[model samples]
Target: MDRLHRQVGAVGLAAAAVLPGLSAQVDQHAAEVRDLLGVRGRRPTLTALASYTDGLLDGATGRGWQPPQHDLVGWAGADGVAVRLLALCALVTSAVA
Candidate 1:
């Protein structure tokens, strides 16, 4: 039990140390995505995109349709597309901050 605890502690420390680098990478990627979408430096555009995607998800849920578990990126249909777009908006906003 003691050895297991130490192993877990070490793993946690390692993860903690890596998190900042991971965050920076994510922010960089988000900036790239925002640029590709032509929303860079345009807060209004990003906000509108987020709102539209949110509405799409809400509308689908209102109709009692289930989003596919394996297609969170929207490869399957409308549900996934909305999720992916919303995520992109979120990433862009986070990067901007």
Candidate 2:
């Protein structure tokens, strides 16, 4: 569970920094993350990330993604999950801004 805690904290920190200026609307920040992960209205933990990615990409592929892979990241060998996280992190940045 320690690793999960760390992951959550890291995500939160990344969110905070990406938020530009600090504010106490943590719940709002959290809501944005959930929405990006497509897991809103529920509490999220580390493990939900992989499942979320799988679900999101499942539909994304037919739209131009090619699946167990995609060109979203443009990296020759970056795994799908990594691409998902990068996308999710980027979404979080946008969600708040």
Candidate 3:
């Protein structure tokens, strides 16, 4: 593989390794926020998910999140997760509408 491919592969591996953990954390955060805000749903609407993710980004939830220590090459932060979540929300919102 070329340098770029190698780098991409490494990042992909890292993401694959961390995804389960990240998913668990995201789930926990969403559940806590939902409970706090009295949101009643197993599956939240895209708008509500976006709103909760906005709370995560804006610190409205008053909780701090730190990604795992295994260096995601600048993708290792709560902001990264929030951005990805927002993208997911947008994707789903567009698909649903």
Candidate number with greatest TM-score: 3
**Over the stretch 1-97, how does candidate 3's per-residue lDDT look in tens digits?**
2232243334534453467654454456555655655764644565665565556545633566542233454333445454344234433433366
Candidate 3 displacement at residue 22 in angstroms: 2.3
Rank by TM-score, highest first.
Answer: 3, 1, 2
| Model 2 poorest ten-residue lDDT run | 67-76
In terms of TM-score, how similar is model 2 to the real structure? 0.31
For model 2, residues 1-97, the per-residue Cα lDDT tens digits are 2332233334543444445332224445445658875767754555555466556556766566542322322233434433344444444444445
What is the per-residue lDDT of model 1 for residues 12-63, given as tens digits with 9 covering 90 to 100? 2233234554334434645555676677875436455555445755786698
**TM-score list, all predictions:** 0.32, 0.31, 0.37
For model 1, what is the alpha-carbon lDDT of residue 78?
30
Worst 10 residues of 3 by lDDT: 1-10
lDDT of 2: 0.45
C-alpha lDDT score of every prediction, in listed order: 0.44, 0.45, 0.46
- Among these predictions, the greatest lDDT belongs to 3
